[model samples]
Target chain A: MQRPLDVLGSSTDKRIIIKTKSGDSIFGILKAFDSHINIWLDEASIDGEKEVKLGKVLIRGDSIVYISPEK
Target chain B: MQRPLDVLGSSTDKRIIIKTKSGDSIFGILKAFDSHINIWLDEASIDGEKEVKLGKVLIRGDSIVYISPEK
Candidate 1:
């Protein structure tokens, strides 16, 4: 059984979607993460009615609800 | 600065609200947690249009968005 981190590790460099607690959907290429789940994303953007480019960002794991590979 | 884990550590035995990726709001008294953020809650319940008791539960951290002290 793959652990959450194992899934994340396999997702590195792949496009992914992250849902935030504040109801924001973020899309990005997963770059890196720490034990706390703090994530580094490349070409990150706020995904909504209008996608807003955010370039690169570090997302606090505490603020994230879920992370999944973009389908 | 207190890390997310520090916040959770301080919240032990305290009533908290956990927002899940599936848009569920869970309320409970925090019992324990591990490095992966998997949480144990006592007297757990789903809070929404109608409250539903869940008794004790182990919440997978991957399914959780944010955790906050109950207001």
Candidate 2:
């Protein structure tokens, strides 16, 4: 019974990666999502910053080139 | 003190709404966001479903037409 929201909600504590249309990749833990499709990504490199907000993004599931979850 | 991710994360418990590029609107509570920009929106009017997941969506901040939080 895996729901789509589950994917977004449970992504916390997991290493998630997102590839944008520009071919740039953003890697971080699942933070939060709102109606605006705004994303809160805690990037990997910044030390102890907790989370960095990526403002709003245009993410069509189709445009998502890649997604890798750390095991 | 308001970070972008904060917007996504705190949207929960609030009556949040999202406007899509197609000129359609989706209303719900903020659930989660991952690197892919995928959104977990708890749409309105779904009766006791708690939350529903909208697969990955293309949401450019600019494309987001409007957002109204319940007062």
Candidate 3:
């Protein structure tokens, strides 16, 4: 069975869309993640009520809802 | 430092609202959880597009966005 981390691991270095609890979506390239699911992303940008360029960011795990790999 | 799990540990046996990736908020009494954040809840109910009673449920962690203790 693929574990949650395993799924995320597969998406590393790939473009993924992360839906957050604050109702914001982050588009970026997955870089790294820890056991807590805290993620490091590059070329990130907020895509929601307020749009902004976020070159790189480490999103707290709890703030994230789901991570979907871009096709 | 309080980790994500630490926050959840404090909410054990308490009423909590879990926001999920599916855009549903689950109201329940926290029971147990694992490292993966997979949670077991009692008296679980969905509060979103559709409402339903779920006596007991184990929610996969990745599907969860945030867990808030009911005030």
Give each model a TM-score: 0.54, 0.36, 0.56
Q: Is candidate 2 or 3 superior in lDDT?
A: 3
**How well is each residue in B15-55 modelled by candidate 1, as lDDT tens digits?**
87775767677889999988777889999999777889999
| Angstrom error at residue A69, model 2 | 2.1
Query: Candidate 3 i-RMS (Å)?
Result: 9.1
Superior candidate under lDDT, 1 versus 3: 3
Best-matching candidate per TM-score: 3
Tell me how candidate 3 scores on lDDT: 0.77
Candidate 2 global lDDT: 0.47
**DockQ (CA atoms), all models:** 0.05, 0.07, 0.05
Cα distance off (Å), candidate 3, residue A32: 18
Tell me how far the alpha carbon of residue B13 in candidate 2 is from the true structure, in angstroms, after superposition: 26
Model 3 per-residue lDDT at B37: 76
Scored by lDDT, the top model is: 3
- How would you encode candidate 2's per-residue C-alpha lDDT over B1-71 as one tens digit per residue? 23334544555555555544444556666566554334555544322235445543334444442233433
Q: In angstroms, how far off is A35's CA in candidate 2?
A: 5.5
- Across B1-71, the per-residue lDDT of candidate 3 in tens digits comes to 22335556677898877767776878899999887778899999998978999989999987875555665
Candidate 3 lDDT by residue in tens digits, A1-71:
76868987788889999888878898888777778687766687778767856655545697778889999
